[model samples]
Target chain A: MSLALSLAPLAYVACPECDLLLNPVVPEPGDKAYCPRCGYLLQRPRKRSIERTLALSLTGLILIVPANLLPMVGIKIFGNSQDGNLWTGVSALFKEDMWAVAVLVLLSSVLLPLVNLGLAFLIGFHLFMHKANNQLARWMHWYEHLNEWAMLEVYALGIIVACVKLAGMAELRFGLGLFAFIGLLIVNAMLSNELDCYFFWQRIAQLTKK
Target chain B: MLKKPLKTAFMQGFIRCHDCGSLLKSDPKCLCPVCGHHVSARKPNSVQYTLALIISALCLYIPANIFPIMSVTQLGVAETHTIVGGIVALIQSDMVPIALLVLIASILVPLMKLLGLSLLLLCVHYRWQVNARLFTRLYRVIAFVGRWSMLDIFMISILVALVDLRGVAQVIAGPAATAFAGVVVLTMLAAKSFDPRLIWDHQLSYE
Candidate 1:
């Protein structure tokens, strides 16, 4: 039986060598399964994944600060320049009576990631201490819940598409916020990797001396 | 030619015992022309569950395509388009990669999932001989990826909410959001409805 079979309900397997979480694959009888990288038997993630996730998430949270504080996309149409970050766009949407869309964007891009980061922090902290905290499990559950809603990459895609559409009509300007946004994405990806549930669970086990 | 009346003939010959060529009455059950064994047959539920999911998926497919996904607005100009239109816009704007992605995620993938689930369901329902295990595994893979189609929808929603600068430029969402959401929800339901036991109908049940 594969390690995935043991831990599947909690988390998926990330190949230690490649860091790619392998999707389910059929195993042949007597086949010695190993990580796609380094040809070593792939088990669960390491204890440090939670720390890494927390560290990256904290960095992401910090980056998010500047990412929002700075202007995102700048429009210089007819020599009049105006730049808007996420909050501005959200406020604009609300003012225009597109309340539902405003709420969706706000929740998906901002609120959800924040909640995910918070959950990752708590989950990682508890696992590191090797304490069986019910709150940690609850937080982990909440993190999982938030992961799907925070579609930052999708939001980014929408930004690019909107930029393309606006090219002929407006003098579009990329601002510092765009760079920050890219940093947010990279940090978010890294955070997601670091906070993998498998690593947390393993760390918890080790702490418990189980 | 005259035909004679046929008479039913009773077995007059007797069975001979190996010891003495002695005759014995024949047994009622067919004990040994050679040998006898009882045969059993029953199908599994996973097959039926898988089939139900597929059918429901097909039911949602038509609505998913026929419905408009989003409406675009600029300078008092408004136009509605289906999933395909969005992809075309991306392509025309030299965002070919994103365009291909949108096409695959929003259009092709959902259709494939619907079709794949349907095939798996039908095979299980009919006890049709095929790779039951493979189908079961494929079902899981499809279910796992079913949510990713939301990428396009999420993008549209974000844009609609964010780009309302008024008089200069503004964007609004159309009726398509609900329809797209319906597609996602319905497909997910279909994937969930499929049962895995149908795969063993022929092999496990009969044994």
Candidate 2:
């Protein structure tokens, strides 16, 4: 092994879960190193992670347009058919003077997910280009914060629950947006789990050094 | 000093940055060299911030449960449902699994979070030295499940969107949806503001 490769194992890592100090043995591609004390994922550096995440993020971003534009569900009640998109619900809440719910929906369902996916794309692009600058680092930080607040999966579950509740009262039909939203949720989740922060920082450090 | 020796990063004069997981020399006001995040041996004012957030969430919890979350208007007869009432409606409609899911996600999880956080805060305040490991696990559970409490709010949004039929039927979000969302957000913020390391800090001090 090269001197640098050998010395890389000397870096100390503290388990975020149990605070156990450990020297991690870097795993091979497709393997994961879990903290022995608390089973917190220590590191898992996948080959071409940036490329894979970038592709997934792009797919999610593409799906978002339809998810927001097309009606999420079609409803027929008393021989009257109506179709409503995600924004329709948001506007309906606002019309009812439920400002807080409207804002929450707009933020969690609409804004945060887009921003999160956008950040993922940006970070992936930067990493792939070997441009490890301070701005990229800052964006990565913002990405971490935004990831916590983006509740697309929760929102998707909510749609399912709504459909179940409304099935008895109305002739319900799933829209194209429903499947698109589901696609977005799955893609976004895969991208999130594939992102290993420690590996990203290490990659950035390598790039900055060169 | 009549105390058992303990091994800790703090005792070795090092602290880990909560944001980027970088280890640095212990300093109350130092910025993390790697991530530019503020570094401290412990999160500054963790208890106070957590307490304030918990109290705010608790205050919102009442109105969230009492007032209507959504109203379903069918044929000019509008029926409103609160959080519990909504669950009851689901049960009446034979959506037993969804009702249970909502009961757990919307109600039980948030309630557990509030109670769990308060217990952790009190334990830290009183310096209770029992089951630190268990409480740490509890904190992890609360933090993991905290954001899921938004399920009900999301459901309300979807319902309001899909069930808009003007005069025949319409699902309208109510004031309580706002309050319920507020409770979930506040509890999540409270969980974020809490420093789980404090639980171990007490152990070090007691030793």
In model 2, what lDDT does residue A132 have? 71
- Candidate 2 on A1-210: residue-level lDDT in tens? 132254344355566655666665667777888755344667876766788878988998999999999877888878778787778878978888888788988998899999989988988888878677776667778888778799988888887887888788889888898889888888988998788787776665455556
TM-score of predicted model 2? 0.92
- Scored against the true structure, residue A1 in model 2 reaches a CA lDDT of 18
lDDT of each: 0.58, 0.81
Recovered share of real interface contacts in candidate 2? 0.50
Give the per-residue lDDT digits (tens) of candidate 1, residues A11-49: 233332122234333343323355342233433343356
Q: What is the C-alpha RMSD of each candidate to the true structure, in Å?
A: 17.8, 3.7
What is the C-alpha lDDT profile of model 2 across B70-154, one tens digit per residue?
A: 8889888999999899899888878899999999998999999999999999999998886676788899899999989999888
CAPRI quality level assigned to candidate 2 from its DockQ score: acceptable
After the best TM-score superposition of candidate 2, give how far the Cα of residue A161 lies from its true spot, in angstroms.
Answer: 0.8
Worst 10 residues of 2 chain B by lDDT: B1-10
Docking class of 1: incorrect
